[model samples]
Target: MTSIISAVPACPQAPQAPQAPEVPQALLAVEGAGLTVPVVGGGVVEYANLDYAASAPCLSDVAEHVARVLPYSASVHRGAGFASQVCTSLYEGARRDVARFVGARDGDLVVFTRNTTDAVNLLARALPATAGGVVLVDLEHHANLLPWRGGGRRGTGDVRCVATQPTLEATLDALAAELRAAPVALLAVTGASNVTGETPPLARLARMAHDAGARFFVDAAQLAPHRPVDMAALGIDYLAFSGHKLYAPFGAGVLVGPADWLDSAAPYLAGGGAVREVSTTGVDWATGPARHEAGTPNLAGATAIAAACRVLTALPPGAWERHETVLRDRLLRGLGALDDVVIHRIWPDGGEPVGVVTFSLRRHDPALVSAFLSAEHGIGVRAGRFCAHPLLARLGAPGGALRASVGVGTTVAHIDRLLDALATYLRVGPGWGYAHRDGQWQPTPDDRRPPAWVEQYA
Candidate 1:
């Protein structure tokens, strides 16, 4: 019995697992978190999206809200089904939400359009026939300038372009003088410069416009996302903004103002929803938002935008301002450290700017730098006139410049990565050859594959 017995070998104990590195909270969580991009050197890295000025990444909350509502989505206004009723309620509710967010007055009307450009163009069409002149500055975006210049068949009065002064106060004074000299019906200005991120004194400008018997209109596309806009409190007669620029990249925009001009003018579009009755001989138009929101509306877009406004408004006061200020200061300090980097700014006294910084390298092409950032590092940025050609010409960079804009989802680490990449590019030029074509820089003999999602969609 002793000979038959055998002892079994003892099994080794399992090794304890190593600790995982702590994951830091984002400066602001947004959709596309931890997205990876393929670099030109055959490796994938986390994508750093810094092009918020052009189009901000959708907020996570907004995306979730849309997803939740998609199941119950239906045509808004004219349906008798339960889904239709829900959709109608949601659409109307969205209008109310946006109005509350901007502090719209009692008689103000909110009309949703495709984008800021479309919203401004709609307003242009609605300009009063009695308006003798339309005054604007050279620093305005094409959306703000071109609409007044060509206001469809209504003709947007005599267009007057005012020159921007070195100081904000001087610019306001010049604008006031022009307003006083001419019978200007409207004084259109950007709440914040899309090119320089410099915010003009809105209250002062509003007063000047009113004093000269002109209605003050603000293109708040750049200002609304960074700062809260109170249309009633600020004495703004009309305001326009795009949802794409406000962390809701749905194709929708808002033009909120008094209803008199909009209602008096012809419907912006001749279609089903715009018309209350249409016969072979003549047509009677529907009133309120339906007059301009022709055909079936983008219910999802409006809802998503409303969700974004709600999320932003719910945040603790000054939370976003504090976060962006810190990031802006860090970005400016980093850029200032680089000797060859020249930042384009409007104010010489270093006035407070939003989270947008435009700059140009001493010896490098802006397009090439932007391309190199994407190819070498996974950083995304915008490099061009930024839709402000006149402003760029005045700033002495007609060729163009690089813009690294920040918003929700942008982090200090992203800014550091961009600055470090710029420094590296300055120290040692790009490893790959690039050629300028069609006003853009592209890598020669490009061999990088598209991301998996793009490939699947394609």
Candidate 2:
């Protein structure tokens, strides 16, 4: 743990910031690996969770880390006793571990927040006034898009969004055109797409942004879990990500970037830890991460995030890519062979993306498909626009899509299970009928009962 704190790389200078799948006994084990859930026909099936893009199950290692540290948890930065001191040490150390995980520059600031939304909003508030504006793309999540959309509390005239093109090269050209048209403060992009699982060339984007006199930022919520991020290597100026997406449960996130603008900006919150002096007449605010994080922090969340970073970083080189590739390929092939299935993609001339695939069955509503899968087959997948309304509009899927993402634990058997379920559903349809209620689809006259623990608790 101490070693992780010291492993973050220091860069000369610069800025910027910031998937799915299934099956089998996963190549990698996660929490709830052997858990069973009640399904249709009064029987149980191992939950076929194919929704890593939304929120992943806790990693077994991360759970163990959480349990190990809970006893030492206490008031952070305020306590003087051994537990408090230890807590404080761990709390502060998380920033370093996270920084190391993302290969953040030496002098970069890692500000902890509730999640990616909070992280993005923090950067939105801290951007230097002199900096022109932020350039966004069509394929951004709401967490990235809404923060800078401008108007009301969000402010306006500081954002410009580009439309994606047919190919990645064309998309880059489109992005470049947008940057050239104006001297923007930053070129913001997602490191890996959540909807289509596309990974734009970060190095090229960084070069494009710098050439246009704009700093580059990446929302790595999707990319970080599948690939490594080196701000220096990628020429990124800022980054943001969520621990929930990284398989840590207590809801932690990070915004890593330069100190210049953040120091110049006002504190994100007005509270105890964010000040050096507080008199009635005037108050001197604190700087660094404390400037933005101004209250009792989530010690467990931060620690869990740090522990997850350690676990991911320790995996053998290319381990994640190898695991997800096999499962993703099997899924893509199976889905492709299915009739009347439209696989949505932003870039036609593409690359091997992260393990996420979104598609729509020709005559099936995505909600019904998801509900049917869950109720009848014990499979879990995301069914929605995925919060990138613009991108969904571009793809002509305003209604929504069904996304299946994989993790290291996902296996060939799991992929086959989902494929088989989808095939069976498309061919024969559900034997039982479903109804829409509470804004979702579910089996009518459902008889499945909750587990004993849930029933007792409820």
Candidate 3:
């Protein structure tokens, strides 16, 4: 059998370098890049944050951007003060920045929400009554799945979960078959699996959905931060992503899409700003994005997202992709060399994955391994079903699995440290005892304390 290492290309084409006006230095520096963590032996090691799939640390530039706007923070939409006017302009300008960043089509509306879940729920509420059904695959995050299943106004559309095939082409074909067989009004799919980081054939799936008279939606919580997304170019009717996962941890998310369904549907939240007029007997509703974005929005969150988007756009064309690929390959090859390691994947041929890698050792509990890595090796990773229980069950790890995800801040040393920690655990058992508590494996007699700054702030 050919080794996976041999199958990888020796020399892939380098990504195009950025032209003049390089990325901001602040954007390049991630907060908590050199954080220190205490090990079990009373020694501290530099923390390796490899759980980027969940939530990434804030980018320095995003933080700076927020600081710059903090002084002028005021009520948006309807205020008489000068601060309010500036704040409103900044908020609206952020909407424009995000629209352009995602390549939104002309007239497309961008609605600000709390997070991707909120954005998807908003879309669910906006589903028109004429829509027939919603089609998605089993390999979706809960955010993408539950909204279509139990959410939506009128609760009219029937939900169908298509099984993912062993190959990307086969999975797309199955989705096409389902779309052809039913009157699918919407097809919601993940841009990339948060668990395995497997990227589906998004463009093909969008084409298929549109050809079958269904609108396509992408849960880009994972994809948007890793790669560029063009709504018009990919034929995506809608897209939802969170700033927390995009190096802007400001509790903001976006839903960028067409206006017809949203404008026709009732406002997501009824409040002072979302209404046109109100009387004792009746009320008139506002149209456009204002119809949905009801109260005072997260002005800072929106600004942070826009700032991060600008930083990403300024980066060399393929620099992020190339950098991540090298790290991913290194991690995969290192894990492959371990005889006791087992890498879990969806496709049989081991299709290309993003920065996330999920696997388990032959004789170790996933949670225990995760705890050991953190407590002894100062490595942070996610260990659980990763919110995609169906996919994990299908992958034969019904209990759970461990996932190590990378991002712009991840370094080759971090990946190596994780691999070395796992190898050490396999060769020699954990140095400390671990027990499952509150559904998570925690070290016994844990004595970890907050950093000095945290204590002072608290």
Candidate 4:
């Protein structure tokens, strides 16, 4: 494939172009790319992080952007110092950048939050009374499901959940029935499954919601990094995503939607910046984004997210999709070749997605297999319910499964490394001994250690 990452800079570089010599020139440069760790068998190997869905590594470009802005970093909004003014501009500009990245329409508000969970909660709290009840799909991540489902929360509309069907068409049909049966205000769903990487038909779902007189909301935390989230074109009324999942490892996320519900409803946070006037008896709340973004905002995190957006948005057309699709296909095909390896997916008709693959080994312990991958092969993957317990139960894997997710920084080499490691583990079994401890399997007498700096903090 043509190199979409590590592209030559538009501006000529200084005398000797600055680059991390050890980091591989892959789809994108990420933190800890070239770090080598000692394996259980007395050999060192480059650490392969296949856990991007959990929290992606920071992009090198975003890190540089953050370093350049650090000198000017200061408290944002209404601060009188020069650094504060600069930071304010950077923070607000970051909001605009995120809005554009998601194809926000006019009158849309971009409210920054701690992460996707905070963004979802803020939206749930800001839902207007007239918007009717919320209709959620059973496939949502806990971030999206927990907020609206909470009891006695102000502005959390009457919540109802619809279980997914065997197929995408049937699932949409069921959602439509639920919406038509009730005076539903919103149809909340995940743009893609974090566990299976199966993307629901978002455009069709959006249309179904509108036809039933309900608005559409997507948990785009998984979709934004791999695919474009054109909210306007997709007819999404509200969307939430996290920067950490987008290669910006910053504690920031955003809610992009119309300002009407947010403006009319109670402020998400009742603190200093959210209010216009503070009286002993009653307080006046501000409007627009400020109405919700209370407390000292994450200016640095917002700036980093904006830097990540800029980097991702500048990619050539179709480059991002092509890169992930090719690599994921390679992984799927390799895993398919393995006997008794059950790859779990929500829909057989699942759409193109980010590179997330969840699988189970029938004769092996999933946690043990994952621990072996890390300790013996220097590969990092997630093994658990993946915070989507409902989906896990529905998939018949209540015991949890192994998840290997790729990112913009992931490469064919990384994909092959994981496949090879799994094959080795399954064929020969984990050569090292592991014991279940602290609710997880650990290699017994593990000799691998973190870099010295990690010890310094301890």
Candidate 5:
């Protein structure tokens, strides 16, 4: 692969360069599965695709799994064809796999939706009418918060929004106070901060929620890929996550929890699969997953997600943890040395965090930073509110900050590219300040074209 460098001004290097394991070429292989992004050139398009918090790349195993089943696609359950039987078996098998993936209890229902947002919306709509006074963290993603807020607008109850504080203890204190003051139905919190990558105290929060007689729904979108999750051990009542974030890249998600709420409530989307029977006067809703999966489900997508779970299970947890920690620390150290960069968080006391790091460039819009990284340096990252508008608004970061999220396939070279870009951009000072008429950022001529390697996959 070629190392592509843009025309940004240069800065002095630090005294030392950290020594880490060489990034494996096999892991960087995104070939053979269709995409032709090249890996060579002086301006080697070094893809530091650090946006795993939003979506991770599909694993080779997942792609193969989908391919193996694609030829057998047919309508499941209703048709008696051989292909249909295979499809039905694979789809249901995927459900069982998901159940095991989350450590679901016997008879726990796994309802597949398009994504975490859809799963959360399903839960929100299904909660009993008496589910008043839901508790939410100020740091929650829009998908987790919006459903409840929208429902509250219909007069469910006083939906309490817990304010942020200096520490987790303080935040928990405020949450406890809110739960005590009202009849709370549920407490929704993230397993990790998408912005900070700091995982919340799930066990402690779970115990607290149960003690307060409220169900706990954890948004594990970020944590599932980095670590193992045992919902039963965590004592969470409900759990939601997406396949795309788990290296599956499929339009499938899971909402697993206690069956009472889901069973009694109406289907989220009124359609064929959800109804057991229909008459002129009324309709009977099926129980468990069928009730919520109203339309034709994405059987292949579900299989891919299940395949991702199996692939992740084969990985050595200790190695995965060690590698990610080293990568994160290396990147943090490099970014920390930059005078203009302000990182969101670093575990000074040596606490564990996921492979996500967020920051802001001084006196610059985050979107510009992201654009320069991509257009000039061949590094892809996400910027802006990241769909957590409330959290961004609370932090007063209206345009949001540049967020570089890593994953299992990421490497040290990728991190180096990001640091080098930042150092270069710092010397240039908000490179090319003219705003486009369409409200988009237009980088200089040097940044207009993508790196040469990108054409390999184009």
Candidate 6:
């Protein structure tokens, strides 16, 4: 008997849109291949992780890379088995990958540290005693600022912090004057601002520092994740950045560039990886990355970081910028249209920035605003001083302002939710009997409709 099987229906697939199905994870994330983490709320809130200037979630691809290598976790370099040999190869390979990722010298040292904080601290301590003077920016994050400050405290050098200006022209002029004033040995600067998302004129600053007989050190913790950072092209003598901020979030970082300061100065930490010999009379140190690393390095973290970099570099650079620009412009336009809200240096002009934006509303404490958004709207945002105490102080932000940072994961819907919640708060006043406490304004229950004066953003 000729039996015919019933025809099976094709599995339903989402209809393709004209432009990649509208990129549900937002433009940046979609372009960067970054993934979003789900919240407990009903609507899937794409993680508007503008705090990428601080830290970013590990890319899904990097996580996969880490998983694939998990089964072969063996001691590297101190090989005893096949697994050890494989682990060592991967570790060294990761170094080469990271070096290329940042456009470092072919043979440059790539030391793996815990994070940017550790990397900067390593460089700070590793500077030779002869390097008696260092210039740093006042707007630097504590990770960058405190290291030099601590170095001065340890009597290593006289750390001079150059005061910053709100405008770039004024900043460059002041920096030039400062560099000309003395025999500067090192100039430490942020490639981009974590608060205002402003990036200084890197190539110009590099030339100025070099001309003034100083080595330029770039704290690229915020810049690397967004754009291409070529150490040689920028003429940067030393560069530091964290894996966490670069979509790896793997307990590791990179300290790349000149080897002289790292080679001659006393090791930052001393233990297994840094030494070649140890005795009562003397201790012989290993050369290159191992010298600074000293202790057991996080091999997995380094490999994962390399994996994340590979994923990021695969995308078209222009696409990354274009996607973020759309989101940034949307944020600026929306925030600007709102009544009583002031957007700081709103997009395109004030300085070359990334997707991060900061703003404040009239009579609203930033802390309360941030807390309310989290509690009621399921919008996760950051508020208060964003670690750079001096910068905030300079901005006259006595209590700080609410910061909404966008990353690869941020979507237009996220911005809309933020705008909606703010409007609701302004119109209805506080809800659920929220009251100000100890100098903070508290929210009180009121009619759902907010005050009439509150305006809607286009």
RMSD of each: 12.6, 10.8, 7.4, 9.5, 4.7, 12.7
Query: What's the C-alpha lDDT at position 419 in model 5?
Result: 82
C-alpha TM-scores of all predictions? 0.93, 0.93, 0.92, 0.92, 0.89, 0.84
Q: What's the distance in Å from true for residue 275, model 5?
A: 1.7
Off by over 4 Å in 4: 1-25, 155-157
Regions of model 1 farther than 4 Å from truth: 1-27, 151-156, 349-351
lDDT of 5 by residue, 39-110 (tens): 212244445677778888888878888999999989977779999999999988998888888887887789
Residue 278, model 6: lDDT of: 91
What CA RMSD would candidate 5 show? 4.7
Question: What lDDT does each candidate get?
Answer: 0.83, 0.83, 0.84, 0.84, 0.76, 0.72
- Displacement of residue 423 (Cα, Å) in model 3 is 0.6
Worst 10 residues of 4 by lDDT: 1-10
lDDT (10s digit) by residue, model 6, range 5-94: 111122222222112223344433332333333332233333444445556766777877888888999888887899888888898899
Model 6 misplaced regions, further than 4 Å = 1-50, 151-156, 346-350, 433-458
Q: Show the lowest summed lDDT stretch of 10 residues, model 1.
A: 1-10
Q: What is the per-residue lDDT of model 4 for residues 94-149, given as tens digits with 9 covering 90 to 100?
A: 98899999999998999999899998888887777667889988878899899897
Residue 182 C-alpha lDDT in model 4: 74
Worst lDDT 10-window in candidate 2: 1-10
**lDDT (Cα, tens digit) per residue for candidate 3, span 1-458:** 21111011122222222222222122267999898998875878999999999999998888999999999999997889999999999899999999998999999999999999999999998898778899989989999998877645544868899997878778877888899997989999999889888887777888888898999999999999888889999899999999999999999999999999999888999887889999998879998888988888899999999999998888988888877787777777777777567888888643456888899776567877888889889999999899999999988888898999988888877887887777667665676766666667777667777778999989
Give candidate 2's error at residue 323 in angstroms.
0.5
For candidate 3, give the lDDT of residue 329. 75
